[model samples]
Each structure stands twice: as structure tokens, then as C-alpha cells.
Target: MSRDITAVFRPDPSSPNNNTFTNITPNSGYCQPIPANCNESGRRFSSFRLPIIFRSTAAIQAGHVDPRQGAMYQVPASWRAVQVANARTGETATLEIRWAGMGSQYNLYTSAVELVGGGVTPHVAHQRLWGGSEWINAPAPCRDGRLGHFNNTIYTFFWHTSAEGTCAKRASYQIPDLYFPFLDFGYELRTPDPLMMSSGQYTGSLTYTVGPGQDVDMGDVLLPNDSAITLHFNLDVDHTLKVDVPPGGNRVELAPQEGWQAWLNSGQKPTRLFRDQRFHISASSRFKMALECQAISGDTCAIFDAGTGHAVSVDVSVSLPNGITDPAGQPVSRRRLLRDGSGTELFQAGSFVDRGMGTLHFEVGRERLAEMLDNGGNRYTGNVTVIWDSEV
Candidate 1:
């Protein structure tokens, strides 16, 4: 929904005529040639004679929609707000507000309507913020990303190749100025609220179908504080699966197992399903796979596939903490590793274990090396996860 608010203010008593107390004549001998004065009539106090003007200083707080049962999903919506300072010298000015867009509507006396009617309109007039409905032609607030708003601040978290960021999402909001024309009158907008209504759908589900039900062992992983990860699954069949991660669910965090260094051998292509990061295996600790699935299904099937459908490439992502270095000493970073399904080159053919995710074995003997001549190089810290597209 979109709307525009217009605030209008006109001066009440705007005349300095009838000079009974002062020695001034009625528009004759006040100054030299009145016409030539360049300040006559309308020109002679045009500001005082004019009506008080006000530009609408309005904003939309965000509102949220639940998306559990709808086909049309709601991407987090956005809106713009503008406030016009009171141009007149009084506080009884009325502002005309209008909006245009999909499913658009508004309330003139917002406080009155909300208090008496009990609706979406905010209880207070100051809370009538703006919100977005359509997604096209909106303002671009990033160098190479789509703009998004949360908590009244505009931010961009979209991924772009050239930007100086990782696969991780980031946000920022601009603060608005406070003091304004309302102060001239004894009453002013003292408590301008900054909270936005949550308009985006916080809940949604993705659906996928597995042909004839192969051994379905995949389950959701609840991470500590992280939000991204890659799951390494050993599949005997090309099964179509859907993995849904709720927005409110615990974020995924991959931590290295205790005493990780002792078990890592040089010649042991000791491949692990999970890693602490995208950097070399040595720089991070690893973990054992803890899948919550049985080997066989009641359908008596040991293998699973999307019902004889050819394996297709599904897109996925992995994120890691900063400051990881490559074996060649290059800075390591997180990125998406694209792959085609059930391919042996990326997976072990007969073993059903997909190793296509490029490996990150470490050669770091026990001594930690320094990256710079300064103090010894920073120790590798933080976690990493691999991400891949999965069937619902």
C-alpha cells in the first residue's frame, strides 16, 4: 500500500492596518513611492499576508503478514515517509494525505478512527507511518543490490559479485532529523516514533516431492547464532527433497570438534561432511555428521530418487567468518560452489557420498605461521558452513 500526506496551514489574522496607536497613514505616507517601494500591498509583507505552508513529514511503519497458507509469497515490503514543517504560526493546521497503489487505503483522522474503531490504524496520530505494496521501480539504496527496510531504516543485503562483501547479508538504516517548525507553537511533536510495522511475511514454507520415497534421512539442523550452512548428504539415489528453514528458527553454526588437530593426518584424505569455515581443513575444526534419518523406509526402499528424474543442479551457498587464509597464503573467503546432482566427479560413485564440494585439506604442521611481519598472524577463529539447494 502507498500513500501521500499533504499538510496545509493558513495564517489566521494577517493584517497590520488601522494605525490608531502609531503615527502611520493608511497606505500613503508610510514610505517613499509606495509602488516604487517594491514592497506595496502583496509585496509589502507578502510573507505575513501569505497563508502558512506545510510539507507533509510522514513515514510508514512496517506491518507484517503471515504467509503459511498462501501461494503468493510476500517479500519484505518497503515504503517512504516525508514530513513538511509547519509554515504557519499555529498548531491547528490540517494536512491532506493521499496514497495510490495495490490494496491501498487510508484514514483521515487516524487517531480518532483507530481509538474508536480498533483497526490497523495506529492508536496515535504520530504512529501513522507509510508502508509499501508494490515492488517495482522502488528506490535503489545499494551499489549493486535491491534495497530493503527494517526498523524504519533503509538497507541493502542482496548479493553482488563486485561488492566488497561476502555471501552474508548486512543492513543499515538512516536516522532522521528531529527539531522542526512545530516548536513555534506551544505544542510540538515531542515523541516522534521510530518503530516500523513488520509488513514482511515472517513465516513461509517450501515444498518438494520425492518420487516413491527413497530413504529420507535428512532433517533440519538448529545452529546456535549463525544463519547459513551446507549439509553433506550421502545419497544412494537421486531423490527430490525440500528443506525448509523457518526465519525464526535457530541459526546454524558449525563448530570444530575438540582435539581436532590430533586426528587430522597428512595422507588421510579425511573428508568431513561439515567444516568450521571455507578455509583449509587445518585452519578450522571439523564435526561428525549427525543426520536424523533411518537407513530404510517402510516402503522397503533403500534408495531414493525424484522418481527416475534426471539429477539437476540446485543452487546453494556457504558462509564463513573473515580472516581465513588459503594454503597458498591467499585470503580465504566464502562463496557459492555450484554443482550438478548425483555426479560422481563431485561425489564418490558407488559410495553414494558426494565429495564434489572442493576439499580444503590443511598442510599446517603444528606451528602457526605469521601472515605479516608484525605480531604473529591472527589465529583462525569463527565458523563456516556449506550450502546447497535441496528438494523440499
Candidate 2:
């Protein structure tokens, strides 16, 4: 969207008849001759003018031009706020604002043209007007100005000097001395949360002001204007899931007992497998998790006596604490290792919740180790596979 704030320069009201005001029409074309009325010798004044052009960075990159052609150059405008809806909550999501284009500098100048001049005389003074606390003369060629940030918004104003010199040797000039006629800026929004954001339309607005520099405000002669720019954002959520276990590995060792009674009297205990298991999941909608386990080798869990050629199959069960839960305070029930079937659900949450980090506690138990010893057990090793699944 583009907004035009035209500036009219006229003689001060105290001396209204001293010099006639001339209105310069802003457009996309090259420089034109100054109005004949601006040639009076008396001190003339110019009112500040600012035209703001707002557009998305994408549109600017695509070379979208303003239909009005108010400014010679076209640039993208920065955003004030970008909102996204959390996938789980379907409401406004947390975000961080990042601005771009502040401190970017651009040159303001009039079109260069050759004027009729005798071989011994210069046609027009080579000069440029620059922006400062007030308008000031700059080295010929062009003047530089930068976009500034304040109160969460970007602002800039322009200064103007009427064209000067004889008709036969007229100088091309910028009506509003220094302005951001073709300035472009933009920003990006980001979040660290794991919850995905919904894909949809979002809207916002930014307010800014334009006026003369500090030195140019002669007793309110140069008034400022406040304007609002609307903003829009379309967000999309990405489904993500991750699970990790300790690096060293989950292992348990059992020593053979002298007899069944001795093994029973020893009071064998289940060893804790992994210190902690971690999982992160995000989805555009609702999600659930399940866990399953199976013996790595043959159908039965067993250990063999190499010398006696005998094997003892043992039942291994995994125990978990029923109190495990997610960041959102949703509980995950205790689950037992399953050799078959669909497995057990760990936890489930609706679209309104976001689960950050999840932890799992596991205990490996050897049932009836003494009974296995009676069958002539030897040193044995086996593997179990644990699977974690997430569905959206």
C-alpha cells in the first residue's frame, strides 16, 4: 500500500504576496522545468512533505510498482508485527521480532540534465540538498540520508528548495529538499518453542510520523502528520518429532547363582536401564505416542550352555514408573514390554497443548532367574528393541 502526503511551498502568510507558491507534481518521469512563479527574489519557504510507500519484501523483489508512481524509486516497507497461531492451541503464538533495513542509507538527487550555457559561463550551480537536524546544502551530485528507528517504528522526512537560476540556464532540483521517496525496509519473526504454528492469515498495524527536522520546525511552520500502515502474515506449521537415548548404551548383567534357593535368597533386583529418555514432538493438530518392545533374536528370550548343549529360556519384563509426564502436565502411564500385539500408549494430548521435553524411566527385571539356573545356565547376552511412535 502506498500513501502520498503532498507538500506545498508558499511565501510565509505574513508576506503572502511577496512570492507565489508553486505545487510540484510528483511522478515517475524524469526532471521537469521549475514553475515560473518560483523565481521571486524574496525569501521563500517550503512546507515539509513525506510520502510513505509500504509493500512486502516479496512484492518488492518481484518488482511490483506503485500505480500512482508518486516516487521515482520503489522499495519494500518493513513490518511492525507478525503473528502466528500455535498448532496445539490454535491461538496466538509466542514470537520474536527482527527488523531489517534500519540504518540503510540512500541518495536523493534531481535528474541530471545539461542546460544552455555559453562556453565561458556555468549554466546552473552544481548543488544538492541533504537531510540533517534541518535541511542543508550538500556537495553537488547527491545527498545521503538513512532510515531511522524510534518507538518501534521507522521514520524519515524530506526538505525542499525551490529551483533557482535564469530560464536559459535552469538547474534541476528536488522539490522537497530531502526525502525517502523510494525507501524500502522489512523484518522477520521467529520462535524457539517446539509447537508448530497453524497456517492461516494474520493481521497487524504500524503507526509512524513524518515532519521537518529539528532545525526546520520554525514555530510550528513545519507540522508533522501521523499515519498507520496495515500488516499481514500467512503462517504454516511443520510437523516434527525427535527421540534420543543415552549414548553409552542400556545394559544389564546377571551373575550365575550356586542354586535356585541361593538365587532366590539373594533377592535379585531390576537394574535401571537408561538414566533418562528424551522426546520432542510437534504437530499442526492433535498427537499421540506409543511404545513397543521385542526380543532382538529368536521368538523366545534364552541363554545356552555351550558345553552341555542345553538352553534355558527366560522371561524378561520391563517396568516403568506410572508418574512420568510431559511439560504440559499430561501423564504417561506405566507400560510393560510387549513381545507381540499393538503395544501400549505412552501419552496423548489435544491441539491445545505443547509438550516440550519428555522423560522415561525404565527397569529391566529378570523373572525367575533361579529357575533358569537349575537348567544349567551359562554366560548369556541378548538384545531388546524399543520403539517410540508418534501419530498426528
Which candidate has the top score in lDDT?
2
- Give candidate 1's whole-model lDDT: 0.20
Question: Model 1: number of clashes?
Answer: 39
TM-score of 1: 0.13
Which runs of model 1 end up more than 4 angstroms from their true locations?
Answer: 1-184, 190-192, 195-392
Span of ten consecutive residues with least summed lDDT in model 2: 162-171
lDDT of 2 by residue, 1-392 (tens): 33222222222324322221132323221111222222225422221122342222111111213322121221122223434454454567443333221122222232212111213212121221111121122211213222122211122322122221110111133322222333222222343232322233222333333322221111112132323333333333333333444454355444432323544687643322223344443322223433333323233344445666554443333332232334455554443344442234333332322234444443323444444455565654445455444432
lDDT of the candidates, in the order given: 0.20, 0.30
User: After aligning candidate 1 to the native by TM-score, how far in Å is the CA of 159 from where it should be?
Assistant: 56
Per-residue lDDT of candidate 1, residues 1-392 (tens digit):
11111111111123211111111212211122232322323422100011111111232112322111110111111221223222221112111111111110112222322322345433221223322221121222212222222222111112112111111111011112111111000000111111110111111111111111111101111011212111111101112111233453223332234433533553322222122222211111111111111223221111122333221111223332232222233432333332222221111011111111223221211211111112322232222223232211
Question: Model 2: residues >4 Å from true position, as ranges?
Answer: 1-181, 186-192, 195-261, 264-290, 295-383, 388-392
Q: In candidate 2, which residue pairs clash?
A: 78-185, 88-351, 158-178, 159-176, 159-177, 159-178, 160-176, 160-177
